[model samples]
Target: MLHGKVVLVTGAASGIGAAAARLFASYGARLALLDRDEEVAALAAELPDAVALPYDVADRDAVFAAVEQAAARFGRLDGAFNNAGIEGLGGGMAPTEGYPADEFERVLAVNVRGVFNCLAAELPRLPPGGAVVNTASVLGWLGGPGQAAYAASKHAVVGLTRSAALEQAARGVRVNAILPGAVATPMLLERGFRANPDFAEAAPGAHPMGRIARPEEVAEGAAWLLSDKASFVTGHTLAIDGGLSAR
Candidate 1:
Protein backbone atom coordinates (compact mmCIF):
# COMPACT_ATOMS: atom_id res chain seq x y z
CA MET A 1 0.00 0.00 0.00
CA LEU A 2 2.96 2.32 0.56
CA HIS A 3 4.15 2.18 -3.09
CA GLY A 4 6.90 4.72 -3.67
CA LYS A 5 6.11 6.74 -0.59
CA VAL A 6 8.95 7.79 1.67
CA VAL A 7 8.76 6.47 5.22
CA LEU A 8 11.05 7.13 8.17
CA VAL A 9 11.54 4.20 10.59
CA THR A 10 13.39 4.77 13.83
CA GLY A 11 15.14 1.82 15.58
CA ALA A 12 15.58 0.47 12.07
CA ALA A 13 18.59 -1.63 13.01
CA SER A 14 16.61 -4.46 14.58
CA GLY A 15 13.42 -5.93 15.99
CA ILE A 16 10.05 -4.47 15.00
CA GLY A 17 11.66 -1.47 13.39
CA ALA A 18 13.87 -3.63 11.18
CA ALA A 19 10.92 -5.80 10.27
CA ALA A 20 8.87 -2.73 9.36
CA ALA A 21 11.62 -1.39 7.16
CA ARG A 22 11.83 -4.61 5.19
CA LEU A 23 8.06 -4.92 4.96
CA PHE A 24 7.59 -1.33 3.82
CA ALA A 25 10.32 -1.82 1.24
CA SER A 26 8.51 -4.88 -0.07
CA TYR A 27 5.42 -2.71 -0.50
CA GLY A 28 7.50 -0.42 -2.74
CA ALA A 29 8.19 2.31 -0.22
CA ARG A 30 11.39 4.31 -0.28
CA LEU A 31 12.94 4.23 3.19
CA ALA A 32 14.82 6.46 5.60
CA LEU A 33 16.02 4.10 8.32
CA LEU A 34 17.15 5.88 11.50
CA ASP A 35 18.84 4.30 14.50
CA ARG A 36 21.63 5.01 16.95
CA ASP A 37 23.16 1.67 16.05
CA GLU A 38 25.52 1.71 13.11
CA GLU A 39 24.01 -1.60 12.02
CA VAL A 40 21.23 0.48 10.49
CA ALA A 41 23.63 1.44 7.74
CA ALA A 42 24.14 -2.18 6.87
CA LEU A 43 20.41 -2.80 6.71
CA ALA A 44 19.92 0.23 4.51
CA ALA A 45 22.63 -1.06 2.19
CA GLU A 46 20.63 -4.24 1.65
CA LEU A 47 17.54 -2.36 0.56
CA PRO A 48 16.81 -0.53 -2.67
CA ASP A 49 16.45 3.26 -2.47
CA ALA A 50 17.06 3.38 1.29
CA VAL A 51 19.13 5.75 3.39
CA ALA A 52 20.56 5.12 6.84
CA LEU A 53 20.32 7.95 9.33
CA PRO A 54 22.51 7.17 12.29
CA TYR A 55 21.38 9.25 15.26
CA ASP A 56 20.05 8.82 18.77
CA VAL A 57 16.42 9.81 19.28
CA ALA A 58 17.21 11.12 22.77
CA ASP A 59 19.33 13.85 21.21
CA ARG A 60 16.86 16.58 20.22
CA ASP A 61 19.11 18.41 17.81
CA ALA A 62 20.27 15.17 16.26
CA VAL A 63 16.71 13.93 15.76
CA PHE A 64 15.70 17.17 14.08
CA ALA A 65 18.75 17.03 11.86
CA ALA A 66 18.09 13.42 10.98
CA VAL A 67 14.46 14.10 10.09
CA GLU A 68 15.43 17.07 7.97
CA GLN A 69 18.14 15.04 6.28
CA ALA A 70 15.74 12.18 5.56
CA ALA A 71 13.17 14.51 4.01
CA ALA A 72 15.89 16.14 1.99
CA ARG A 73 17.13 12.78 0.82
CA PHE A 74 13.73 11.45 -0.15
CA GLY A 75 12.30 14.83 -1.28
CA ARG A 76 9.18 14.24 0.84
CA LEU A 77 8.24 12.22 3.90
CA ASP A 78 4.96 10.32 3.61
CA GLY A 79 5.01 8.44 6.90
CA ALA A 80 6.99 7.54 10.05
CA PHE A 81 7.31 4.81 12.68
CA ASN A 82 8.66 6.18 15.94
CA ASN A 83 9.87 2.85 17.35
CA ALA A 84 13.14 3.49 19.14
CA GLY A 85 13.04 2.83 22.91
CA ILE A 86 14.80 1.10 25.80
CA GLU A 87 13.29 -1.34 28.27
CA GLY A 88 14.90 0.38 31.28
CA LEU A 89 17.99 -0.02 33.41
CA GLY A 90 18.90 -3.70 33.67
CA GLY A 91 15.76 -5.20 32.18
CA GLY A 92 13.59 -2.64 34.04
CA MET A 93 12.02 -5.04 36.53
CA ALA A 94 12.18 -3.13 39.80
CA PRO A 95 9.70 -2.24 42.50
CA THR A 96 8.27 1.25 42.07
CA GLU A 97 9.62 2.50 45.39
CA GLY A 98 13.06 1.08 44.66
CA TYR A 99 13.08 2.01 40.99
CA PRO A 100 16.06 4.32 40.78
CA ALA A 101 15.03 7.88 40.08
CA ASP A 102 17.83 8.29 37.56
CA GLU A 103 16.69 5.23 35.67
CA PHE A 104 13.16 6.56 35.52
CA GLU A 105 14.40 9.83 34.18
CA ARG A 106 16.52 8.02 31.63
CA VAL A 107 13.60 5.96 30.39
CA LEU A 108 11.33 8.98 30.08
CA ALA A 109 14.02 10.91 28.27
CA VAL A 110 14.34 8.26 25.65
CA ASN A 111 10.82 6.89 25.32
CA VAL A 112 8.66 9.99 25.90
CA ARG A 113 10.99 12.85 25.08
CA GLY A 114 12.46 11.01 22.15
CA VAL A 115 9.08 10.49 20.52
CA PHE A 116 8.27 14.12 21.19
CA ASN A 117 11.45 15.19 19.46
CA CYS A 118 10.69 13.09 16.43
CA LEU A 119 7.12 14.35 16.22
CA ALA A 120 8.20 17.92 16.64
CA ALA A 121 10.57 17.55 13.73
CA GLU A 122 8.48 15.31 11.48
CA LEU A 123 4.96 16.78 11.72
CA PRO A 124 5.77 20.11 10.13
CA ARG A 125 7.44 18.40 7.19
CA LEU A 126 4.60 16.06 6.42
CA PRO A 127 2.00 16.74 3.76
CA PRO A 128 -1.76 16.67 4.22
CA GLY A 129 -2.07 12.90 4.02
CA GLY A 130 1.06 12.00 5.91
CA ALA A 131 0.82 9.49 8.74
CA VAL A 132 2.80 8.57 11.92
CA VAL A 133 2.80 5.61 14.26
CA ASN A 134 4.34 5.54 17.73
CA THR A 135 5.24 2.29 19.44
CA ALA A 136 3.60 1.97 22.82
CA SER A 137 3.32 -1.29 24.81
CA VAL A 138 0.60 -3.59 26.11
CA LEU A 139 1.91 -2.62 29.54
CA GLY A 140 0.57 0.83 28.85
CA TRP A 141 -2.91 -0.61 29.40
CA LEU A 142 -2.11 -2.99 32.25
CA GLY A 143 0.39 -2.71 35.06
CA GLY A 144 3.23 -5.17 35.54
CA PRO A 145 5.29 -6.09 38.59
CA GLY A 146 8.45 -4.01 38.80
CA GLN A 147 7.75 -2.19 35.55
CA ALA A 148 7.02 1.34 36.62
CA ALA A 149 9.45 3.24 34.43
CA TYR A 150 8.79 1.28 31.26
CA ALA A 151 5.04 1.31 31.77
CA ALA A 152 4.99 4.98 32.57
CA SER A 153 6.96 5.84 29.45
CA LYS A 154 4.67 3.79 27.24
CA HIS A 155 1.63 5.38 28.83
CA ALA A 156 3.07 8.74 27.97
CA VAL A 157 3.55 7.55 24.43
CA VAL A 158 -0.14 6.64 24.19
CA GLY A 159 -1.06 10.10 25.41
CA LEU A 160 1.27 11.65 22.89
CA THR A 161 -0.21 9.62 20.05
CA ARG A 162 -3.81 10.50 20.89
CA SER A 163 -3.09 14.16 21.47
CA ALA A 164 -1.07 14.47 18.28
CA ALA A 165 -3.77 12.70 16.33
CA LEU A 166 -6.34 15.17 17.60
CA GLU A 167 -4.10 18.09 16.77
CA GLN A 168 -3.38 16.89 13.25
CA ALA A 169 -6.66 15.24 12.24
CA ALA A 170 -8.08 18.41 10.75
CA ARG A 171 -5.02 18.73 8.56
CA GLY A 172 -5.49 15.18 7.21
CA VAL A 173 -2.47 13.85 9.06
CA ARG A 174 -3.00 10.63 10.97
CA VAL A 175 -1.19 9.69 14.20
CA ASN A 176 -1.64 6.46 16.10
CA ALA A 177 0.07 4.17 18.64
CA ILE A 178 0.70 0.42 18.63
CA LEU A 179 0.73 -1.52 21.89
CA PRO A 180 2.65 -4.74 21.38
CA GLY A 181 2.78 -7.76 23.64
CA ALA A 182 5.82 -9.91 24.34
CA VAL A 183 7.81 -10.18 21.14
CA ALA A 184 10.80 -12.38 20.36
CA THR A 185 13.24 -9.51 20.21
CA PRO A 186 16.59 -8.84 21.82
CA MET A 187 14.93 -6.35 24.10
CA LEU A 188 12.83 -9.15 25.54
CA LEU A 189 14.98 -12.23 25.09
CA GLU A 190 18.42 -10.98 25.93
CA ARG A 191 17.49 -8.30 28.38
CA GLY A 192 14.07 -8.94 29.86
CA PHE A 193 14.40 -12.70 30.04
CA ARG A 194 17.82 -12.42 31.59
CA ALA A 195 16.41 -10.17 34.24
CA ASN A 196 13.41 -12.33 34.98
CA PRO A 197 14.18 -15.98 34.54
CA ASP A 198 10.56 -17.08 34.46
CA PHE A 199 9.56 -14.55 31.83
CA ALA A 200 10.52 -16.64 28.82
CA GLU A 201 8.52 -19.63 30.02
CA ALA A 202 5.45 -17.77 31.22
CA ALA A 203 5.18 -15.27 28.38
CA PRO A 204 3.50 -17.53 25.81
CA GLY A 205 0.79 -18.67 28.19
CA ALA A 206 0.14 -15.06 29.13
CA HIS A 207 -1.32 -14.57 25.67
CA PRO A 208 -4.44 -16.41 24.62
CA MET A 209 -2.69 -17.18 21.35
CA GLY A 210 -0.29 -19.38 23.40
CA ARG A 211 2.78 -17.77 21.95
CA ILE A 212 4.79 -14.61 22.02
CA ALA A 213 4.65 -12.40 18.90
CA ARG A 214 7.19 -12.08 16.19
CA PRO A 215 8.53 -8.63 15.50
CA GLU A 216 7.05 -8.77 12.01
CA GLU A 217 3.60 -9.31 13.46
CA VAL A 218 3.79 -6.01 15.33
CA ALA A 219 5.36 -4.35 12.30
CA GLU A 220 2.41 -5.39 10.13
CA GLY A 221 0.02 -3.34 12.24
CA ALA A 222 2.30 -0.33 11.97
CA ALA A 223 2.59 -0.73 8.20
CA TRP A 224 -1.16 -0.57 7.71
CA LEU A 225 -1.53 2.36 10.09
CA LEU A 226 1.07 4.27 8.13
CA SER A 227 -0.48 3.40 4.79
CA ASP A 228 -3.43 4.89 2.93
CA LYS A 229 -5.53 1.86 3.88
CA ALA A 230 -6.09 3.35 7.32
CA SER A 231 -6.67 6.91 6.24
CA PHE A 232 -9.58 7.45 8.63
CA VAL A 233 -7.80 5.85 11.58
CA THR A 234 -6.26 8.26 14.05
CA GLY A 235 -5.85 8.67 17.80
CA HIS A 236 -6.34 4.91 17.96
CA THR A 237 -4.38 2.51 20.14
CA LEU A 238 -3.91 -0.73 18.21
CA ALA A 239 -3.11 -3.77 20.34
CA ILE A 240 -0.89 -6.13 18.40
CA ASP A 241 -0.70 -8.51 21.32
CA GLY A 242 -2.25 -11.80 20.25
CA GLY A 243 -5.17 -11.30 22.66
CA LEU A 244 -3.02 -10.61 25.70
CA SER A 245 -5.00 -7.47 26.47
CA ALA A 246 -8.31 -9.35 26.12
CA ARG A 247 -7.73 -10.73 29.58
Candidate 2:
Protein backbone atom coordinates (compact mmCIF):
# COMPACT_ATOMS: atom_id res chain seq x y z
CA MET A 1 0.00 0.00 0.00
CA LEU A 2 0.69 3.25 -1.39
CA HIS A 3 -2.29 4.93 0.17
CA GLY A 4 -2.05 8.71 0.53
CA LYS A 5 1.08 8.84 -1.64
CA VAL A 6 1.59 10.66 -4.92
CA VAL A 7 3.44 8.60 -7.48
CA LEU A 8 4.77 9.24 -10.97
CA VAL A 9 5.15 6.64 -13.74
CA THR A 10 6.77 7.23 -17.11
CA GLY A 11 5.87 5.16 -20.24
CA ALA A 12 2.34 5.15 -18.90
CA ALA A 13 0.84 4.74 -22.35
CA SER A 14 1.07 0.94 -22.20
CA GLY A 15 2.71 -2.25 -20.95
CA ILE A 16 4.45 -2.35 -17.59
CA GLY A 17 4.11 1.40 -17.10
CA ALA A 18 0.36 1.40 -17.69
CA ALA A 19 -0.06 -1.69 -15.55
CA ALA A 20 1.88 -0.03 -12.74
CA ALA A 21 -0.32 3.02 -13.06
CA ARG A 22 -3.43 0.92 -12.63
CA LEU A 23 -2.01 -1.09 -9.74
CA PHE A 24 -0.70 1.94 -7.84
CA ALA A 25 -4.02 3.70 -8.24
CA SER A 26 -5.79 0.67 -6.85
CA TYR A 27 -3.59 1.05 -3.79
CA GLY A 28 -5.05 4.54 -3.37
CA ALA A 29 -2.05 6.49 -4.66
CA ARG A 30 -2.52 9.61 -6.73
CA LEU A 31 -0.77 9.18 -10.06
CA ALA A 32 1.12 11.31 -12.57
CA LEU A 33 1.37 9.34 -15.80
CA LEU A 34 3.88 10.40 -18.46
CA ASP A 35 4.51 9.12 -21.98
CA ARG A 36 5.30 10.41 -25.44
CA ASP A 37 2.22 8.68 -26.75
CA GLU A 38 -1.02 10.68 -26.86
CA GLU A 39 -2.73 7.60 -25.40
CA VAL A 40 -1.32 8.55 -22.00
CA ALA A 41 -4.17 11.04 -21.76
CA ALA A 42 -6.70 8.32 -22.37
CA LEU A 43 -5.09 6.01 -19.85
CA ALA A 44 -5.07 8.77 -17.26
CA ALA A 45 -8.68 9.56 -17.99
CA GLU A 46 -9.64 6.02 -17.06
CA LEU A 47 -8.21 6.30 -13.57
CA PRO A 48 -9.30 8.19 -10.49
CA ASP A 49 -7.02 11.02 -9.30
CA ALA A 50 -4.71 10.67 -12.29
CA VAL A 51 -3.13 13.16 -14.69
CA ALA A 52 -1.58 12.20 -18.02
CA LEU A 53 1.42 14.14 -19.26
CA PRO A 54 2.59 13.82 -22.84
CA TYR A 55 6.37 14.20 -23.21
CA ASP A 56 9.46 12.47 -24.49
CA VAL A 57 11.86 10.90 -21.99
CA ALA A 58 14.78 11.75 -24.30
CA ASP A 59 13.95 15.42 -23.94
CA ARG A 60 15.62 16.66 -20.76
CA ASP A 61 13.53 19.79 -20.55
CA ALA A 62 10.35 17.86 -21.09
CA VAL A 63 11.27 15.40 -18.36
CA PHE A 64 11.89 18.18 -15.87
CA ALA A 65 8.71 19.99 -16.82
CA ALA A 66 6.65 16.87 -16.35
CA VAL A 67 8.15 16.17 -12.92
CA GLU A 68 7.64 19.77 -11.83
CA GLN A 69 4.07 19.78 -13.10
CA ALA A 70 3.24 16.50 -11.40
CA ALA A 71 4.61 17.65 -8.07
CA ALA A 72 2.77 20.92 -8.36
CA ARG A 73 -0.51 19.24 -9.17
CA PHE A 74 -0.20 16.70 -6.39
CA GLY A 75 1.22 19.23 -3.91
CA ARG A 76 4.15 16.89 -3.29
CA LEU A 77 6.14 14.15 -4.96
CA ASP A 78 6.58 10.88 -3.10
CA GLY A 79 7.80 8.28 -5.58
CA ALA A 80 8.47 7.59 -9.24
CA PHE A 81 8.74 4.60 -11.60
CA ASN A 82 10.96 5.64 -14.51
CA ASN A 83 9.92 3.22 -17.24
CA ALA A 84 10.02 4.96 -20.59
CA GLY A 85 12.29 3.22 -23.11
CA ILE A 86 12.64 1.93 -26.67
CA GLU A 87 13.85 -1.40 -28.05
CA GLY A 88 15.20 0.52 -31.11
CA LEU A 89 14.57 0.05 -34.84
CA GLY A 90 15.78 -2.82 -37.04
CA GLY A 91 13.85 -5.15 -34.80
CA GLY A 92 16.38 -4.55 -32.00
CA MET A 93 17.87 -7.94 -32.87
CA ALA A 94 20.95 -7.30 -34.96
CA PRO A 95 24.35 -8.81 -34.47
CA THR A 96 26.74 -6.55 -32.59
CA GLU A 97 28.95 -5.85 -35.61
CA GLY A 98 25.95 -5.47 -37.87
CA TYR A 99 23.97 -3.19 -35.59
CA PRO A 100 23.13 0.19 -37.09
CA ALA A 101 25.09 3.05 -35.60
CA ASP A 102 22.11 5.38 -35.53
CA GLU A 103 19.82 2.81 -33.92
CA PHE A 104 22.40 2.16 -31.21
CA GLU A 105 22.59 5.85 -30.47
CA ARG A 106 18.82 6.13 -30.41
CA VAL A 107 18.52 3.26 -27.94
CA LEU A 108 20.97 4.91 -25.56
CA ALA A 109 19.22 8.23 -25.93
CA VAL A 110 15.90 6.81 -24.84
CA ASN A 111 16.78 3.98 -22.49
CA VAL A 112 19.94 5.22 -20.77
CA ARG A 113 19.76 8.98 -21.13
CA GLY A 114 16.07 8.98 -20.50
CA VAL A 115 16.55 7.47 -17.05
CA PHE A 116 19.40 9.89 -16.40
CA ASN A 117 17.21 12.87 -17.22
CA CYS A 118 14.33 11.64 -15.09
CA LEU A 119 16.57 10.97 -12.08
CA ALA A 120 18.22 14.38 -12.40
CA ALA A 121 14.84 16.07 -12.50
CA GLU A 122 13.06 13.98 -9.88
CA LEU A 123 15.68 13.54 -7.14
CA PRO A 124 15.61 17.12 -5.96
CA ARG A 125 11.85 17.24 -6.26
CA LEU A 126 11.27 14.32 -3.90
CA PRO A 127 10.61 15.03 -0.28
CA PRO A 128 12.11 12.89 2.45
CA GLY A 129 11.03 9.21 2.31
CA GLY A 130 10.60 9.30 -1.44
CA ALA A 131 11.36 6.22 -3.52
CA VAL A 132 12.11 5.51 -7.19
CA VAL A 133 12.20 2.32 -9.25
CA ASN A 134 13.79 2.15 -12.69
CA THR A 135 12.78 -0.46 -15.25
CA ALA A 136 15.92 -2.25 -16.30
CA SER A 137 15.93 -5.73 -17.86
CA VAL A 138 17.34 -9.24 -17.42
CA LEU A 139 19.57 -8.17 -20.31
CA GLY A 140 20.89 -5.55 -17.94
CA TRP A 141 22.79 -8.31 -16.22
CA LEU A 142 23.03 -10.89 -19.02
CA GLY A 143 24.18 -10.17 -22.54
CA GLY A 144 21.59 -10.62 -25.26
CA PRO A 145 22.49 -12.64 -28.34
CA GLY A 146 21.49 -9.99 -30.87
CA GLN A 147 20.52 -7.12 -28.62
CA ALA A 148 23.76 -5.37 -27.81
CA ALA A 149 22.33 -1.87 -27.64
CA TYR A 150 19.40 -2.87 -25.45
CA ALA A 151 21.62 -4.84 -23.11
CA ALA A 152 24.06 -1.95 -22.78
CA SER A 153 21.35 0.58 -22.11
CA LYS A 154 19.82 -1.56 -19.39
CA HIS A 155 23.21 -2.11 -17.82
CA ALA A 156 23.61 1.62 -17.69
CA VAL A 157 20.26 1.89 -15.97
CA VAL A 158 21.34 -0.62 -13.33
CA GLY A 159 24.51 1.34 -12.64
CA LEU A 160 22.65 4.61 -12.54
CA THR A 161 20.17 3.28 -10.01
CA ARG A 162 22.94 2.27 -7.65
CA SER A 163 24.87 5.52 -7.95
CA ALA A 164 21.74 7.55 -7.41
CA ALA A 165 20.70 5.53 -4.40
CA LEU A 166 24.03 6.22 -2.75
CA GLU A 167 23.82 9.92 -3.46
CA GLN A 168 20.35 10.25 -1.96
CA ALA A 169 20.74 7.82 0.93
CA ALA A 170 21.22 10.54 3.47
CA ARG A 171 18.32 12.44 2.03
CA GLY A 172 16.00 9.49 2.76
CA VAL A 173 15.20 8.93 -0.91
CA ARG A 174 15.56 5.35 -2.06
CA VAL A 175 16.48 4.52 -5.65
CA ASN A 176 16.25 0.99 -7.07
CA ALA A 177 15.85 -0.94 -10.31
CA ILE A 178 13.74 -3.86 -11.51
CA LEU A 179 15.11 -6.28 -14.12
CA PRO A 180 12.34 -8.17 -15.87
CA GLY A 181 12.62 -10.88 -18.49
CA ALA A 182 10.57 -11.21 -21.66
CA VAL A 183 7.43 -9.57 -20.41
CA ALA A 184 4.54 -10.01 -22.84
CA THR A 185 4.35 -6.31 -23.58
CA PRO A 186 3.77 -4.93 -27.01
CA MET A 187 7.38 -3.84 -27.11
CA LEU A 188 8.51 -7.41 -26.58
CA LEU A 189 5.90 -9.02 -28.80
CA GLU A 190 5.94 -6.60 -31.71
CA ARG A 191 9.64 -6.05 -32.30
CA GLY A 192 10.62 -9.57 -31.35
CA PHE A 193 8.04 -11.06 -33.69
CA ARG A 194 9.27 -8.73 -36.40
CA ALA A 195 12.79 -10.02 -36.04
CA ASN A 196 11.80 -13.68 -35.80
CA PRO A 197 8.36 -15.05 -36.49
CA ASP A 198 8.80 -17.49 -33.61
CA PHE A 199 9.75 -14.79 -31.10
CA ALA A 200 6.28 -14.35 -29.65
CA GLU A 201 5.45 -18.01 -29.68
CA ALA A 202 8.78 -19.28 -28.45
CA ALA A 203 9.46 -16.72 -25.73
CA PRO A 204 7.79 -18.88 -23.09
CA GLY A 205 10.43 -21.55 -23.48
CA ALA A 206 13.10 -19.09 -22.45
CA HIS A 207 11.69 -18.90 -18.96
CA PRO A 208 11.83 -21.78 -16.54
CA MET A 209 8.21 -21.11 -15.71
CA GLY A 210 7.36 -21.99 -19.29
CA ARG A 211 5.90 -18.53 -19.92
CA ILE A 212 7.03 -14.99 -20.28
CA ALA A 213 5.89 -12.60 -17.55
CA ARG A 214 2.82 -10.47 -17.96
CA PRO A 215 3.03 -6.69 -17.65
CA GLU A 216 0.96 -6.79 -14.47
CA GLU A 217 3.38 -9.23 -12.84
CA VAL A 218 6.23 -6.80 -13.37
CA ALA A 219 4.05 -3.93 -12.13
CA GLU A 220 3.48 -5.68 -8.80
CA GLY A 221 7.17 -5.68 -8.12
CA ALA A 222 7.44 -2.02 -9.07
CA ALA A 223 4.51 -1.05 -6.88
CA TRP A 224 6.14 -2.70 -3.88
CA LEU A 225 9.48 -0.98 -4.55
CA LEU A 226 7.86 2.44 -4.77
CA SER A 227 5.93 2.05 -1.57
CA ASP A 228 7.03 2.73 1.99
CA LYS A 229 7.05 -1.02 2.51
CA ALA A 230 10.43 -0.93 0.80
CA SER A 231 11.75 1.86 2.97
CA PHE A 232 14.90 -0.03 3.88
CA VAL A 233 15.48 -0.98 0.23
CA THR A 234 17.65 1.11 -2.08
CA GLY A 235 20.31 0.64 -4.69
CA HIS A 236 19.02 -2.90 -5.26
CA THR A 237 18.30 -4.65 -8.58
CA LEU A 238 15.31 -6.94 -8.23
CA ALA A 239 14.80 -9.62 -10.86
CA ILE A 240 11.11 -10.01 -11.54
CA ASP A 241 11.64 -12.59 -14.24
CA GLY A 242 10.12 -16.05 -14.07
CA GLY A 243 13.46 -17.70 -13.28
CA LEU A 244 14.89 -16.80 -16.66
CA SER A 245 18.18 -15.76 -15.11
CA ALA A 246 18.41 -18.87 -12.93
CA ARG A 247 19.63 -20.78 -15.94
lDDT to native, each model: 0.94, 0.92
Model 2 earns a TM-score of 0.97
Stretches off by above 4 angstroms in model 1 are none
Quote the positional error of residue 116 for candidate 1 in Å.
0.4
Per-residue lDDT tens digits of candidate 1, residues 82-113? 99999997684789999999999999999999
Q: Residue 152 in model 2: shift from native, Å?
A: 0.4
Q: TM-score of every model? A: 0.99, 0.97
Estimate the TM-score for candidate 1.
0.99
Residue 136 C-alpha lDDT in model 2 = 97
Top candidate, metric lDDT? 1
Best by TM-score: 1
